[model samples]
Target: MKRILLTGCAGFIGSNFVKTIASEQTDYEFDIIDALTYAGRKETIQEELNKHSFLQFHHLDIRDSSKIEKLFQERKYEGVIHFAAESHVDNSIKNPNIFVETNVLGTLNLLNASLKLFKENEAFRFVHVSTDEVYGQLTDDEPAFTEENQIKPSSPYSASKASSDLLVQSYYETFGLPTMITRCSNNYGPYQFPEKLIPVMIFKAQAKEKLPVYGDGKNIRDWIYVDDHNKGVWDVFLKGLAGEVYNLGGDSERRNIEVVNIILEHLGRSKELISYVTDRPGHDWRYAMDFSKARKELGWSPTVKFEEGIKKTIDWYLENKTWIEMVKGNNK
Candidate 1:
């Protein structure tokens, strides 16, 4: 069986990717590594691991270079899908140091290990997962960001991601390490951390609490289902040209208020719960992606529509109260 190393398998998108691949592809065996940070929960993936004998889990932080190097030396992985990082924007605003350390330095450690291993193992590939926030804000009339757009990140979180993206591409350029980068729009689905917008609104609205909206709630984003995003990532990892960047989007553009209202409707809540708050510092006004490259080149596009995906997500959270409660309790 092909051996693959997957980082951040206990986090939201990472966990989803693990489940998707385990069910869709039977030829690969996976070794998942996660630190179980506030956003990373083992329960998110415990059931999947129980079902798949080929899946293994390790509790380790990527920032620990010694431990990371030792693991890479021990295992001969044919590929790596890196997803571990400090992703919350609010937390990054409060503390940027961890973002830089984990996203930038941690990525460097992975690249160094890959460099050494790839020299010996010619089949090794590295896929660096990133966010569309690395391109900064866009106006209503502006065309959606493509891979060629200059990086102008607005927040420390995005800046760290941009730094990591650059580092990954640099490895391919300077060291000839086989690498690919993927920048994706907003993702929402099951197992998402409660701190994100959709889940936060779902949790608060269920409790009949005020759902806070930043600014006038006019900030726009392109939302992609986690499953679709993960599928696109896997496609790119398998078929994309080395050193290329692919953007994945849902093609569903909606304002923040619209998203909140949709969640309210799905949960049978009221608009009266909507509370407009001060906008965040360096908040991007809009984010959209032209994923034609991914669609045309990789034969990948989003399969889930927002309307259907959001309802499914709401239902998942409603049905799996224990999972959300565990995540909330651990975060506290």
Candidate 2:
């Protein structure tokens, strides 16, 4: 049985990944470590807790180097799938130091522990989950960011993630650690924190409040379903070559205004609800990924279309009002 340690297992993407693996791999053992930070919630995994024997959860911060070291010493984890970080761009803008500390130092702590533990086992792989924002904005004329794109992160959050990616690469180059990195586009689906674009818009519309659209809402983002993004990460984790980077996108590019309009239409809300506000500092104009590598090598393709996925996501949030309420309560 493969014993895998998944960090940030309570956040949106991480939790989705855990659920997917739990359903698919009955014999696989998973040990989840999450700090239950403002973004991490136990309720994310509560549904499968009673049902999955192969899964275990631990409430711990990745920054606790000693605890991380101890866990590594005790557990025989075959692989480490890292997802923990301060991920929100707005929050990162408000407090960049936390982003640097968590995204860079936290990742380093995990890398250090993994390297030390896997010294005797060179075949162990480390999958670092990252974002396409590291590539910064793409010009209207420029094509999507491929794996070969140079790093040019603009926001503090993206910079921190880029820093972590560099550390991952250093581990691979300096120590020959088996590592793979996946940079994926914006993900939207169930259990997402309301601070994010899709959920925030949905909630504001439901409350009959102004849906804040940053700037003119012309910024473009390739929207990939959370589950599809998770599958792309797993594809890179299991079959990808060490020291390589892969880009994963749903190939569905939508302007921010377009997304807001779609949500409004789906919920039977009016476009007048959209309030165009000042854009955040250093907001990227666009982010699109060229995911041909993952598709060709791992045979992974996004199955859900943008319209269908967004509607399903809206329905989920509507049905699971308790979860949304609980998450909102935590921010207080």
Candidate 3:
């Protein structure tokens, strides 16, 4: 059985990926290491915990070098899908040092551990999950960011993520450590933290509170459904060549206002609640991914339509109000 170590297994994306992997692969041994940050909750992994015999949990922080070293010393993970990091842009803006510590240095800690572990096993691969925000903003006519786009991170969050990407590349160059990266666009689905745009808007709209729109809400982002993003990760992890970077996107480009309006429409809510707020500092104007390389090389594309996905997302938020409340810190 292939042993897989997945970091940040309690976060929105990581937990979803774990559920998908556990359900699909019943024979593989999966070890999850998570710090259980504010955004990561044990409730997110409940279904997988109850259902999968091959799944095991460890409450370990990636920044703790001894803990990470011990984890590598004990298990021979055939592959690693690293998803752990401080991911909120607002939070990063408030405190940039934590972002640097966790994102840049923490990533290096994992990479170093992987380097030591790989000495015993030569064929393992490390898949580093990243975001498209690392490319900063785009002009109206500029082509979508392909692998060749220059890195121009604007925020502490994107800067930190970009820093980690550089470290991942350095490992590949200096030690020839097998590593691959996937820079995915914004992801939304079940179990998302309420701080994000989609879930926050859903909550505020449901309560008739202000649906805050940063700036004019014209900023564009390529939003991919979380399940589709998971499939993209698995595809690149299993089939992608080492030291390569793949950009994963849903090809669903929607402006901020358009996305909010769609959410309101799905919830049977009004647009009167829409409120314009101050734009974030160094906020990227737009982010679009060029996934042709991924399509041609990995033979992968998103299966969900944007409208259908949005409807499903709205329905999920409605049906899983209990989960939403828990994530909001109101249930506890």
Candidate 1 lDDT (Cα, whole model)? 0.93
Could you tally the backbone clashes for each prediction? Answer: 0, 0, 0
Q: Write one digit per residue (lDDT tens) for candidate 2, span 1-332.
A: 88889999888899888887655785678889999988889888977766787788888888889999899888878789999999999998889999988899999998998898679677689999999999999877789999999999999999999999999999999988899999999999998988999999999998889999999899999999999999988888889999999999988999999999988888899889999999999999999999988989899888889999999999999899988888878553
- By the lDDT metric, which is better: model 1 or model 3? 1
Q: For candidate 1, which ten residues in a row score worst on lDDT?
A: 17-26
**Model 2 CA lDDT for position 93:** 88
Model 3 Cα lDDT, one tens digit per residue, 1-332: 98989999889999999887656885678899888888889788978888887888898888898888888888878889999999999999999999998899889989989998788888889999999999989976789999989888999999999999999999999998999999999998988888999999988888889899999999999999999999999999889998999999999999999999998887788999999999988889999999999999999999888889988988899899888767778442
Alpha carbon RMSD to native, model 3: 1.2
Give all TM-scores, in the order shown: 0.98, 0.98, 0.98
Where in model 1 is the C-alpha error above 4 Å? Answer: none
Q: Point out the higher-scoring one by lDDT: 1 or 2.
A: 1
Candidate 1 residue pairs that clash: none
Candidate 1 to native Cα RMSD, angstroms: 1.1
Model 1, residue 272: displacement in angstroms? 1.0
